[model samples]
Target chain A: MTPSLEAVGLTKRFNSFTALDHLNLKVEGSKCVGFLGPNGAGKTTTLKMFTDLIFPSEGESFINGISVQQDRKRALAVCGDLIETPEIYPSLTPREALEMSGALRGMRPEEIRSRSAAVLEEVKMTEWTDQKVGRFSKGMKQRVNIAAALLSDPEVVILDEPSTGLDPRGMAEVRSIVRGLKKGHRLIFMSSHILSEVVDVCDDVALLDRGKLLFADTLANVSQRLGGNTRSVEAEFAAPVEDSVLANEIGSLPEVASWSRADARRVTLQVKGGPAEQARLLRQLASLSMGLISFRESRSALEEVYLREISVGDA
Target chain B: MSADVAPARAGSLPIADGAIGTVPGTIAQAITLSRYQLRDYLRSRRFVLMIAIVVAVGTILTTLVAYYRPVGLIDNANNLYGSLWGGGAAFLILFAGIIFGGDAIAGEFQNKTGYFLMGLPLRRVTVYAGKYLAVLVASVVSILLFLAIVVGNAVFYLGVGAVGDLGQLFESFALALLYLLALMGFVFLFSSMFKTSLYAVLVVAVLFLFGFSIIQSVVLALTGTEPWFLLSYVNQIIAYPLTGVPEHVARATIGRATITNYAPTYFEGIAVMLGYFFLTTIGGLLLFEREEFT
Candidate 1:
């Protein structure tokens, strides 16, 4: 059976303010889908509903094809979630906390002990397993939270902004752990406002704004379709080229939509079309005696698409 | 991804295999939750504070009894037990309920721990029942410690043979336990009512400590009617088995008007306590069930 998560017409309202409006999304199989949105884009609200931490005002959430609102226990039996930085009891060690989690899930003592060690190791919290959570840092607690979510080896894991409050190194470590999770047969639904983080770890990206979904698709497809038929590339030269000569040569190429010089040796261009067009432009550049050293597509293509979509959504 | 597809049956889907086992029933889940929650309570600072309060109260009473050596209290076991256990047990129960249960549910929201527990395959009712059970057990332990101190004093002052009527003492103890349950039910209701632990703890503490007593007094003074509905009025029954039931109503005329004092009968007290236990416990569970972890 395939792991799946679905939100059918899911809507949530706090008084007059709608946190999530008519959300309908479904993810299947073993993949990591990033739920991307701005500060108040209802990302955490949606994940809370899916985890049964908050009830939906309209529609329903389902886990593995079981209705979350109707049969929460059975629906979440094979699911694990870390919603909004849930704190463990200060008095309890990670081992004790995970033991409680495992017991609640009906895991036997032997199973709990072995799995506790395995998940603690997976989160790189093996040394702190017996230490009280009160003494751990935010990143350590977050790792313990993640380890608890993985204690049951759940097929579907829901994480709400796992790296929201972490430092740079902490964020990198969390992303690495999330990347490692993809190796298993699991459907990971993670929410984040960090665009670059989503680009780094997510296979599919679902963009939401002001309680509405703007688009949902694979990262490649989103970039290709919404990239406005153009891609940005950067070219580095071994030596400085005359401005007039560089402009005249770039203007002669039909594939070059726009160009800008970062310095005497580096030039950025918005090249028209796909890899073939980029290849033709690079060939044309190499043909000129401009001492070209290296050329690569800039990594901000997704950022451009995201900004455009979000602006369009706001408009 | 398709949103229109029908939901798959849970049985048809791949259940978590290997180390993961089937989820337990509600009772087992509640018990498991109770075990962990009890562990937390045991290690908490409030538990130590409660024990200290009990010991301090016991120490004060012990010193006064030993120094004064009151003929009435030292000569008879019933008077000693009634004055010591009956008089102090209610306050101990109130403190115990407030210390252990005042934030049992509200702390989950304020501290954001529910975000972790509620995501699992456990029901709201299970969480409520489990926390209530933990509070009950912890409160009982404190109450029993106070009782031991009372019995210790009785043995010291009146000798082993004069340790009061064991039957009446046990009956009073049973009544005290009943009162503890009712008070905890009320504490839990307040805990479920608010999202902030401070508010829940304060409201419960004030109401149990003096709020209800004041209201009971006001009602009796103004209406000249029985305050039988009040838990404070009914709590007198915890000691009445040892001290003998008092007159249901006593009226005295000062200069202009007559003031009335009302006492709850054994039947009325038991009925009121049972009503509070059922109504407040069920009401708290319902509130917890509907509350969102927002």
Candidate 2:
């Protein structure tokens, strides 16, 4: 589990404004880690620093344990970075652009030819390989942009809000691509502002606020630790039940603070106690004439922890 | 670098097929990037426009020289050197620099192309050197093509024997290229300084075409001093080969004031162009290196 990407005391300042403070983070192994933050939280700045697009005011970053500032050529050689909204030359065809990019990475002739096809297909842009990128839509351009990053088959793929400005369909397509990349032995680090997007695609979340790492751990850990005893649970029924019966059953549970029948077969309840009381309620509901099919947390617990941490940082 | 990134297994990457070359040195990367960038420039619309402009001007100059055959212009060498390099070549060099180098650096930042390029393992100095070489090749090719057409016509009208002193044409050509490098260096400097492509192109075009001459004129008019420091003074050497250069010239009685026009010698002209080349080229690269893609 050697670290794929590491930042040590990294900082960036612009005149009086501090874009990123002294920050340290190390992501190891092959997995998708979500770099989450509010707008102006220095996600893009961190990505830029990793790629050596700008020098850090203090400290440094490393790729595969090679200091980026010391040996940038070797450090980033195995990385594919898509920072902000990077555009390929409008005049170049996708194939031509990929070939150029491959050559720049020192790939041989046959390697460029072969990888040009492979990356174009990976981004689902094989059909439009010969067409000029100038005519491409924003989503198509973004796909090609990501495709360029994949040309080198980098061990660490750094995407800075890849879904930004893409339509819903484009977002879904990019998400699918990210999901597909997980099977490979590559560490994908993507930054996004959307909470649900991170929850859906990332195995780990590193939340930042005001240029500080608020928390960095598994989504499950964050949700479990922050999900308090008083939690909302959604219950689904096998068949429709009358409103009177649902109310009588709701009144029978002492732990239930509030209850509502969302539909003929579903009920949402705010249980006051922890998991034990919630489990007792489920058992009690199963014993009743009301047939229960499933029970689950009503909302993403990660959202709660995120809000709490962000508020604390703000204070 | 962390155990060679998992031993570079063949086709382990979805994008790459079997194997790839080891990461190259800075010079190697720069050369590779330059080759592609040069190809892109050659295929660009600006390159086509530059060719057309050079062709049109060369045709007009040749046609006029063949039909009118200026009275004092004794031979093909005299006519070719005087009108072609003196007029057509000077403007071509300026236009070539403007057409290619104006948006060279600014376009990367303005278009956000640098976001991806700078993300690569390559250094900023590599990117800068690659682009500089690309523009240089494009400009030199265009200028030489224009001169070729003029030379071809020289053979047609005045015969090959009449154009004996062709060596002077080459010397003039060399001088023109030196001026082009200097002008393009300035263009690149402006390109790196500004964020907008239009501003870079406009500023360069204005200064080269009319701004330099106007400034030089104003300085001389106000101070009664020769503007030897101006690069435009040295640019005159591009055409000076065709016409005999006097040691110095003085115009009398500009409303009871006499003014001197100092002519730069061949060595002096080269020194001036080299100064611009070094000063602006270094400045441009420094600006490009320090610039942030934010």
Candidate 3:
């Protein structure tokens, strides 16, 4: 069965406050879909409902067409999840923790042992297999948590802010692990507020704010659909140019919507139109003999869409 | 650098083609969870602390019997067992229930470990039963340790041949086990009621240690009625088998008031324990099932 996760009209309310409101989304096939939302935007709440950690107040969540509310065990049989920052028993070792996870899923002892080793190595925690989790750093424990989620190798994997509390290197390592997960033909539904991480790992992005979904589409399509006809790029000059000289050169270009000096030698430009317009503006700037050194996108296309949609959502 | 990024081989463990291994039934899942949970308990500091408490209580009883050599205690096996085992078994059971079960359910939520366990294919019933089973096993180990010390003292004082009423001693032990069950059920209910381990442990400790006894006394004195509904009242049966059943009620006059004392009969005691075991255990599971991991 092609792995799929669907949330139809899902709503969750804690007394007067709605944590998730009428969320409707369906993700299918083997790809990474980022559940992107700011903090307190109900990203975690939605994932909890999918994994049956919390029940939906209205509508339903389904995994591979099986209703999570009706038959949670069977529906989740093909699913693996790491929701919130789940702590393993401090007394347990990584291997022992993974073994328990496998046993709970009904894997035979031999299978559990073999898969436990494989997953530990996968998360690069083989050296810490027998070490007590109490002795591990936050990053190490998070890796073990991820390894437990992958122990069964289910068709669908859900991760909730897997790098929420990690250092820069730790965050990079988690992103690398997530990128590798996408290669195994599994549908990865990951929630995060980190836009760069999503752009680096997710094939599709779903923006949510204040319990409402603002947009959902592929990364490329999000920029095209919502980014309008303008794109931002940073340009570098070989020498420091005066602000007026730079403005006159950029202002002469019909495609240049706006410009700002980032530094003595760098300027940011907002160009009208798509890639053609951007290329034309780049050429026009180069012909001006203003010592153009480099030109590149200042922010990711998804980041732009994310900021715009989130600000619009705030409104 | 962004475009050059490729999928690394970090989490690409071999994926199973379709569904992973067949998910176990609830019973199997509960057994697996209980086995691991028991291992954790065995390695925990709390387990060591419980052992220490049992040994301390046993040593104090042994030293008192040896140094003083009270005629009331060493004169006969029944008196020795009754004074030591019967008099002290309920307290040991109460301590065991508090130590093993006070934070069993609440810790899962407080520490966020439930987030890891609840995401699996296991049902909430399985998790509840598994933790309860682990707590029961740990409590039983502590109870048995206390009993061993009691038996050791009995043989030293009365001799093996003179140790009286082995049958009655076993009956008391059985009743102690029932009381343990009922007390643990009550403890787990409180644990399930709170999301913080400190609250659960504090509430269970307070109620068992002083709250119920005070309430039982107040109820008996104020109404001149039976405190049969109180677990502390029913627990007297644990010792009654060895001490012989006490009177159902006794009356005394104090100032202008008639004060009443009551003892639960074997049948009433067993019934109340069974009622607590069923009602509180089931109630705890229902609460756990409905609680959201918010």
Candidate 4:
């Protein structure tokens, strides 16, 4: 099957600012690929180029093998996009907005109505279908925007920060809906800042920093590279304590490789792990009246890989 | 989990517009986009408010004119048509054109929603054409509403003996449509040129209210050129059907008067305005086709 989206040597610039530099990426059909990056790291810019919101300054992109620059209309016809904030007509209800979108894509009226209702229901926005989006809360509007993107049953759906403002419940709803879409269209979502959402929904990830792709691979591979040496154990003190005392205790633990104060009240430990040593470390923290916030004995998460790659630049 | 496991599913690659199936012509794509725009514009509260205001203003102006300068029964049809078409209809379309067309593309840029919209399954021409047609239709709707009010007022004034001149009335209305199209063309051009809606509206307002007039006066005064050379003069070609030909002050007779030569005939004047429309529109599109989102 044709790859749903592909970009080879895609470069875009704004005067002196290089938003995306020689970025190469490919997303297979019927999969979810998370576009991971930090702000000013070209995540939104890349999405813009793919969606043809802005043409690339240097290289080219193709959707289903159609050049984005050479044939914008056909490319856009099958691709549904929600970039940045979903700034739709304030006076339009979710239903009206979707219906309008469906008509633009050449869907008939009855098809628009049924499809719109189904997408809204899938996003759990049926209750707010008739209410004007102007009054919708941020999470509510995001869901409505997602519904609009899905209205035409696009073969490729690209979302930039799709879950930015969603509450936990709303975010989960979006995640599951995106996951369910994995069976058909290729889904390319930019979740640069929201690491957890990317982890939960995306099967693969492309880590970007400073307008360059640092790593583009399966999430599992990226995590394993960083996760093998990392552990996230949070300890909260019952009372304020000196760094020296806690640091000494943490330092003496043979398996502990690094420790960092997450906040004034909590210290997160990174330790080598085995069942016996992991239990001992928990006992030591328990005896000190250090309330355990979280304890995980697992591999590195997307967050760790992201921080590790980015921190190397900072160092 | 196997560390080397590639993602079992690969999302698809980026594709161009109209490639999934077939790319339609620019006009076809534009028309489809315009259909949605028309629906949205009709439902917009601002659009509704604009119609109401135009109609109310037309009614008030027509009533005041009838009461103050009551024409004898002999020329009642001509007199009423003149008052409404010249004064009420002209003014309402001016305002309507500004409201509907002055911010067409600029609004898309300002809201950043263009990011999603410009990426659609059509070309830039389709996007632009769609928006322009929608604005044109919406402006026409407002103008039509004002026309209705004027016609209604004429019926009330003439009462039982009143004979409304349907022929002259329609002629005036057709001319109004041409005037609106020409004027709105300029406004849409400006809308696409600027990124901010307010700036687009302001520039259009100035051109309509002052810029064109000022240019006409200066060109006529200094260069001894016809005022028709100015955009505002061209507009009068359409505006003068309601009011009889405006008397031109001879430039030689008055040292300070801006009038230079006689205004062009209606066709010549329209051609000139059409020239301005084509220039500005092409210019705006060229600029927009290359502009960055930031």
TM-score of chain B of each: 0.93, 0.88, 0.90, 0.80
How much lDDT does each candidate structure score? 0.87, 0.81, 0.86, 0.72
Tens-digit per-residue lDDT, B1-294, candidate 4: 111223322433444342223434667667877776787678887697887888678868766766676655224755676766666665667787788777778888897657556655666666677887888888888877777766676677775344446666777777677777777777877888889999999998987788877887787667776776566566555545555566453444466644346666777666776776677677777777776566
Which residue runs does candidate 4 get wrong by more than 4 Å? A227-269, A273-294, A297-299, B1-29, B72-74, B157-164, B239-261
Model 1 chain B lDDT-worst window of ten: B10-19
Candidate 4: residue A166 Cα off by (Å): 2.0
| Best-first order by lDDT | 1, 3, 2, 4
Give the root-mean-square deviation of each candidate in angstroms. Answer: 2.7, 5.2, 5.4, 5.0
Candidate 3 chain B has its poorest 10 consecutive residues by lDDT at B1-10
Predict model 4's lDDT versus the native.
0.72
Count of clashing pairs, candidate 1: 0
Question: Local error of candidate 2 at A218, Å?
Answer: 1.7
C-alpha RMSD between model 2 and the true structure: 5.2
lDDT of 2 by residue, B190-286 (tens): 9999878999999998987799989888987888676767787778888776776757555656887666777777778888899999999999999
DockQ head-to-head 2 vs 3, winner: 3
Residue lDDT tens for model 2, A1-315: 243777778899998889888777878787899998989998989999989888899877877777777777777778888988888777778888888788888888898888888878877889999998878988888888988888877788899999877888778878888888787788888999888788888888888788877778887677566534567789898999778776776655887888888888888888876678988988888888577899887866677677778887888
TM-score of each: 0.93, 0.88, 0.93, 0.85
Worst 10 residues of 4 chain A by lDDT: A291-300
